[model samples]
Target chain A: MTSSTTESEFGESRESDSDNPSVTKVARSKLSIALAAVFCLSVIMGTGPGVLLVNRPESISGIPLVYAWGILWYFVQVAVVIVASLTVWRSTGVAESCRTHNAPSRPERNSAERGEGELPR
Target chain B: MTIPILVVLIYLGVLLLFGWLGYRRGERSEEDYYLAGRGQGWFISAMTIMATFFSSFALLGAPGMVYREGLVFALVSLNVPIAGVAIYLLGNPIRRAGKRGGYITQADMLCDHYGDGVGLRLLVALVGFLFAIPYVMMQLKAGGELAAVLFSGYDHAFEAGAIVLSVITALYIMIGGMRSVAWTDALQCALLVMGMALGGISLVVSMGGPSAFLHEVNQLPTSSLTVPGNTGFWQLPMLFTVCLLMPIGGIIQPAQWMRFYSARDADTLRRSALIFSVLLTGCFIFAIMPIGLGGQVMYPLELSADGVAPNERVGSFDQILVVMLDDLMPRLLGEVAGATLSSLVIVAIMAAAMSTADSNLHALSALFTRDIYSRFLRRGCSEREKLWSGQLLIFVATAFSLVLVLIGSRPESSLSGLMQMIVTLALFAVAFSIQLLPMTLDVLFIGRGTRNAAIISLSCGLLVAFCFTPLFPLLFAKESSPLILWINAAKELIPMHASAWGLVVNGLVFVAVSVIESRVLKARSV
Candidate 1:
């Protein structure tokens, strides 16, 4: 099974230099974060207060003049996610990491890596 | 009685068919039995995630919530697509870390930060499965009740579900390992999408427009719509937080994380998440929400007729969506939609159940094979012994869960509420763990701390959630005389609403404890 282990199978393995984290990279990341924030905001804006804003006779659950409150709740939800994205992006602190212990032996790793997966370009 | 019994038998037969197919294909190698050799493609992987995520709750329960609540409740399900996006964003980190650390379970990621294997996996599994049991029962109970209503209340519907569901999942997981599970999941996802989309639109069109229904809803008093009722201040915030956090809860579930290993590559995992996030969430919400709202509009009088609340009815709030569709709609559409939704719902529910169950079953098998049985029970076991032992353990654990289901599950229980509770609490646990920033700090920065401290922090967070959020209220709040009413009222508050704020409390304790422990460890090293 250990017949193949091509280098290309690995995608930019986590070996980035961070000591002087590049400004351009940081700027690029922030842009991505802002884009995501905008996307989430758009969805929330599109759906959150739909009926609430219209002052329709039919309430969310028949309560008078209350759909606006539900819509407001969605606004807050959108704000929170947007904040988290911005905060996480600003810190450049690593996103949480995954770790496995009790290593399943070198031979096992070799066997598990038996077949290389080809990723599309 | 005979027909119900036959219906159960037929259902069980379907389960057995899947199970037998799996077990027959079982291989001797561990990888074959565990991860389907990780040869799964994007389609299967995506289905596995969607199917696992979709579950019976989405099929019957989420819509039920929407039925009982409103489209506002649809926000609770909005996290569906977010899960796929989250996976895409987080997949590289997860896969990379898994590669570096050789992590198997969801706990590994956190354990990576804590720099230890000590009980993190077990703590995760125990808490998750503990919450999961009620959910498992909800599915079985929903399946049973649905059958009972449709087939005239067969006494053995759940037992049949247990036979069908438990056996099929165990067999596939046991036989094809992750491969069969993923492939089956893809098909399950397809069925779910088709079933829910067609079933939902059909139900909605037949019911007439939602706008017509809302007209009646607006006439109710302000307070009823405000806090303490449907869309109160505390409700949406807590619900939104809960729903938003639901995607991250996947961070802890071993079933979803196992996909980390199952993906063809990190890219495949990302793509699957993005694709599924767009597709499944919409189909699932659309499928169930409209039907639920349709019921909310058309069937309220019947639901609220008795002195009891609408959610506490005999069949179940979750089953109400199906009931409304089956009973009120045109007969042929009802039957076809019923069967389609049921099959879709069944597969989705099964996929959700097994996505966790198979993962749980396999992880437990691995934990036993790698962590416990092989480590302590019998040292120097052979390869075949490990393989067979893993299979045997999966069988035993699954059987045990079924037994637990039979014992723990009550036909009279609230399926919709129980389903929500499990997913809700799982988020609480995960969110709570994020609180132990000290543990995170310790591992990433090599801050001095022992595995014991990290382990305790996990335990502490879990303990706080169980003690304050749920058990305390159940034990004390309802026991007192005047206090009982207040306690019931208090259950609606933010912290009490699914113990939404418990995550905050959990974080504080973990970080404080970890920081203190880190200082102590530093002094010792010095």
Candidate 2:
């Protein structure tokens, strides 16, 4: 029963400056904001008031209109994620920020002391 | 019954073996116990997330709802993808914050961001615990109901099944911690997907073929084929509210929150999101929908104006999938193969239940130890002590859930279907969990509001949510509660889901209080 009081175990460094917010970072943030806003509106439109328009007895591809509309958005959401991940999210360097070995593995802990939860090497 | 029981027993044995392996691999630290040292690969992470998200509700409650309501609940099924979108949008930010802040539990992250002084830690922990309990209880109920069906005519079979499933899930989670939970969840996810696809296919083929199956469904009442659906329970407004709010509740809950923290990397989560949004969830909606619709044709319901009126003839809607598989699979596949396939499907359903149960119990133990006992009762307790405390809480929580299941299972129990009650309880859990949404958004994205606003908003939100729930009336004797009458009047006028009502109140209060408090602080400084 021991408490790991060392700051290293927590993966926090008061001195580290990984997230140096820059103009590019701000632009990326704005893009993320725009994407989030669009996503929310899509959800509301597709699932909310949109249900009224498509709530019909008509069939397309043998599927009812409402069910068809619902399924359409399922694909749309996936496409949204793909577009965001590939375009806006990739260039932000957040993926690189994610590679830091924050958790203490048995061998890794004993082997070295490096910055954790941050870019490696 | 014998074959299915044997198959399930074998499945349980394999889970136990995984648990033992998890124990061997586990280290003596909270990181290893709770987050699996954050080293899960993309595939494993994807499967675990999918499995934990689905649970018995997807297999049982969902199909039952579809069978009862028709196309309306199918739209409800679309919420899974909405949750997938939430994972991609909300999950990455939370993961980034979790890594940066070194937070494990939901409370850990929230308390870290908002400052723990104004009771943010305890409030988040309480909401999480409230959500986890009913979620765990429902999974336990699914186990018992599955057993009662498989072992019909056996006395105390339901109780035995519930207890056994609880013990096995708890043992594995306690032994290996998150590592075992994740690994077993992967196994469970595979079994779940295979079972759903195979089961759906078997269902379709038994009735003839795809065309024949579609013909049968099309011949049903037009209400079943349209929106507002057969039951009319999913009216446009209610449907809108449920579709919008429910997925938020589903993703932001405690277990899913921790999964975001435990991911190996952003790439892993992105792939996981792909599987979640497209592959797994897509398969689920496609596969399970046909089986449920087929159930309607097999056992036709008498439709009144609103929808399929509740008829005692059909018995429990929850048992539709189970009953259909039992009767149809044998006739379609041939005797031995049908029995074996049906047995595997039954085990898959059980796997769904166990996967969710283990996750919630594991999360509860973490929340109790880290957020409550360690934080308030004794700060700086050793990691080993906290782990042991968590293990102990798992047993206590399981026992409490078992008592509730037994009471619900009784002959003269006031509650209806065990599955239905479980579903209600899970929604109640979500009602409270959704209260955390504003706080979550504030922490993850907006970065506004003080601790006082969080505490007050959550408190008022839970109050409004409780009042809107059926429990509020029942607690006060439904006929005797004047407040119930008043609320009923209001509900009739508005026609909104309880969770939606709660969210509105919660959002308004959070914004108002935050604005007022911030202005007060500004004026004082001036």
Q: Relative to the true structure, how large is the alpha-carbon lDDT of every model?
A: 0.53, 0.76
Q: Model 1, range A1-79, lDDT digits (tens) per residue? A: 1222222232333433244446646865686777677657644543333323543334434433434443343345444
Error of 2 at B240 (Å): 1.7
State candidate 1's DockQ. 0.11
Report fnat for all candidates as fractions from 0 to 1: 0.09, 0.26
lDDT of 2 by residue, B1-526 (tens): 5777688879988998998998898897897888888777788888888888888887777777778877666677766767777776777777766665567888877765555553777878888887888788888888887776666678877888889889999888888899889999999999989888987888888888987887777776777777776756677777777777777887898998888889876666777776787776576567788877888888887776554543453446666777887788788887788889999988888889999999999999989998888877888889889999999999999888878777877766654332354456667677888888898887766766767888899888888987887666655556557877889997787766778888889889998999999999999999
Q: TM-score for all predictions?
A: 0.74, 0.88
The DockQ for candidate 2, computed on C-alphas, is 0.16
Error of 2 at A6 (Å): 30
lDDT of 1 by residue, B1-526 (tens): 3433444455445544555565566565665566665556667777777776666656665665555555555555556655655665555445555555555555544544443354764665465455444444444444554554554456776567666667766776676555556656665566666657765776656645555545544543333333333434234455555555556555435566667656666546655765665566556545665666566555662323242235333265556755664554435455544455444444444444445555556666665665555645788888789878878977887777667556545545332222333333344334443333444344434445556666676566555555444434444445556755554465555334333344555555656776787798789999
Instruction: Name the top lDDT candidate.
Output: 2
